[model samples]
Target: MINLYPVLKPFLMAVEPEAAHRAALGLLKSGLAPRYRHDDAALRCEVFGHVFANPLGLAAGFDKDAEVIAPMLRMGFGFVEAGTVTPLAQEGNPAPRLFRDVKNKSIINRLGFPGRGLEYFVAQVSDFRVAQGAGAAADGMLGINIGINKETASAFEDYSRCLSALAPMADYIVVNVSSPNTPGLRDLQSENMLDALLAGLMAVLNSLDIPPVARPVLLLKVAPDLTSDQRAAVAQLALRHHIGGLVVSNTTVARPEMLAPHLREEAGGLSGALLKDHACAVLGDFYRLTDGRLPLIGVGGISSAEDAWQRIRAGASLVQVYTGLIYEGPALVPDILRGLTARVRAAGMAHISEAVGADIDLAAPRAEAAA
Candidate 1:
């Protein structure tokens, strides 16, 4: 498919960020979005028991309500994650919540987890599956990212509710505990609270009537601002609970020095090119702390092939993109896949999985100590 984002760039930039996002989604839902298909055997890898066509995936925020999964999959991503959907719909934060620093290729959004809630989200997914026939997700995997409502007194209730409602249709379920825009959401990452949260969620999963083979794997999304100690605690808790995987390093609260001064003070998590280094650093930390035992999905500031390769070598079995799509558009998926295919051949590796953690030595004293 031809890349039309270049022509659309000027117009998209002229509109407000949130408006531009809605326009983009409307285009996708209406089948106006361009589609690209590039599937290379070298790019295939197994993650969380499912074999993904490639390591690159669309991160959760883009399809916040599961509206456009099929269109995105047709655009060449190996997988697409939908929703940070809550049990109940929310309007999210006030307007002006999404801000763009075009110069730095970054965005700051405090748009909490706004969506049509679980019932609406589940209905959309079910319709997608039915339309695709029995082989839904055959082209690419589907992940559902679940989150809590703004006023929920009990986090477990919200999370478990979402899990029960969405897990049946998801290839995997991501428990999002790291969105900075949601009030007190980050606090759940604390060791004590996280321990309890994971335990309760696991219990709920075990109680589900789905057969063992069909049950979706559970993953946790964490913040990028974790201290070394906090990272260690999370790693241990994940191992203890037998969690399926971790979406390493969500958007950062810390603004890079290179970010535009005015954009720096925006009250939200920051993502884009400026976030690449720190997100990779956090991915490396989690890899070492977990001793590379857990699968990690690297995301944040990935707009090119080299960025994806760096995350793979740094210990991410898979990587995802959100902000990168805003800057690079539909062609980004094929571009990265082609680059990765080349990189894998140049490195003399048969498949992309061989390059995972190529940059880290799990036997190092620090890693051993962390473990």
Candidate 2:
């Protein structure tokens, strides 16, 4: 029997990018899958106060809104992060916003933080609450990716607004200041900028009658293009403010040498194969810097079981993927979980946490040195 997906993707890619995304969401919501579920086994674990069935999670920018939660949950990822939702729902950048360099198995996208606003998303969370028994909610980690608006003058207010709305609804909330697509967004990673943003947001989080960090984790996502000093600064900030967790990367603005012709000219952050080494390198560095004091959501260029395990071993207690799914489809989720379990067994570890930072030498904390 001919597999329908291979025949469909080419044609799908031929259509407008945003429209095809809608169609994919519809298929998932309608309970369609490219293959049958091979693993219904629960792979639960506790992390950041919530119980995650598996370390696998859908990365941000995949479901910029919670439009396909029920369907994505049915596919078996332990968690799904919806949105990078902003304060306002706006159409993203102009067309050709998404591109596939199939030869390199990489994708470049400038889908500027497009989202349906926090108010709309809170409603989404309520209407589509994943049963704590059979969904990302039940598994212990349903994240709402938080971000600022592309045109907003006060990015801090944008983040604060989203946090206030999502704190009660989300299992954990991620503060995204790392997407390269939004001009000046990644600049938030600067020490002064990050300090200001997190300080403002933290005030709001503390005031929440039910803060997300009341076992509600605040995760920070970042761009991969940071220098060693910048990475150290982020670690210091994360430690200083008690950031509950982190997503190691958003996407890369740097186009590596392996990129094919015209690949570099495209405007957007790059993900997939090209990002593998750099992403891992940064994770390793962060692991060394933090000394295992923080929880991290590893992301970028993970397309295989080995890739996921590498992040786990590097210090990420959890992992997320976006581009890999675009290229490989739904089957990728289970493959990651099964691979991770096998890797754990091979390492002769009884629990996944034992495998974290196994090879990375976590040096002393940066704060101690500064003091």
Candidate 3:
């Protein structure tokens, strides 16, 4: 394990962010990406009815079309969430939609879930499933992240269609209604809309010919910017609907004063280092609001072991990373896991779960009183 990113970052970063992303994925798909090994068992986590070898996962945007899943898993991720796959193929936002704030180690992108249509997506995962059964990386948990097509008038229809076709192959399914890139997408996160969307998707799952035990776990990806009322309401809805878990956040639309002016001007969701505090605060809020009843997968701003440990203590059962990889490279995963193990041992916890929400006082002050 040589950390190749330092040597590669200059060339990679010099290219347009989006192209560099594609190139990185291509390298990964071609088995040319660097690999790291982690034998630590302390970081194992059980969430959403599946056991993850570790809490770290590759977030959805990195492999939007389900490519490089095995490569990613082999690289030592406990799991890989694939797609914000829509009902139809989409071009997403125009070129230059992705921007890097090297100074702040953040990214702003309005990539509106551009992906090959569900049919193609299914074909790819179907191949993966088949290969998995035939001695591929069976230990790797695969989650399918579903979303509505940009032009779809009925969000429910698009979600239902995606679930009906892809759920059987997914260990869990994420209904992504929080992306800010698509117009009106965040509207679905509203209490009424979110409930309807989730309920409809669940009904579709239930109606399937498969046994109840066979249905994939359903999770929701929410915005980081939700108000307190919204957080509580969504938490209630998630519990009411028996949603399996929540991906604590998508990216943020708000630009902090810390961002460089040029990067701040970009119009899209912001992710990376800048998102750490905001993402953890939201995770802590949801953990408290849900009363620790619901499992949470924390995403955003986690670039190191300490960051992952903080989120775990803040109440995320598992954590994910995307932009951090853009900055820190694959070695980040091993480093995080090592750090988590150290933290767990230092905290006198045998398992990482014992650390979940261990520091409620340290969590961001509640949006309303009483954190």
TM-score of every prediction relative to native? 0.97, 0.91, 0.96
Report lDDT (Cα) of residue 59, candidate 1: 95
Q: Lowest-scoring 10 consecutive residues by lDDT in candidate 3?
A: 362-371
What is candidate 1's lDDT per residue for 3-61, written digit by digit as tens?
Answer: 88999988998999989999999999898878877768888888888989889999989
Query: Candidate 3, residue 316: CA error in Å?
Result: 0.2
Regions of candidate 2 where Cα sits further than 4 Å from its true position: 1-7, 14-16, 34-43, 130-140, 211-215, 363-371
List model 2 lDDT by residue over 28-116, tens digit each. Answer: 76756543233423345678888777878888877777877766666777788999899898888878688888888898888897778
RMSD to the true structure for each prediction, in A, is 1.8, 3.6, 1.9
Going through the candidates in the order shown, the clash numbers are: 0, 5, 2
Q: Rank the candidate models, highest lDDT first.
A: 1, 3, 2
Best by TM-score: 1
Relative to the unseen true structure, what is the C-alpha lDDT of residue 348 in candidate 1, on a scale of 0 to 100?
Answer: 96
Candidate that beats the other on lDDT, 1 or 3, i.e. the better one: 1
| TM-score, structure 3 vs. true | 0.96
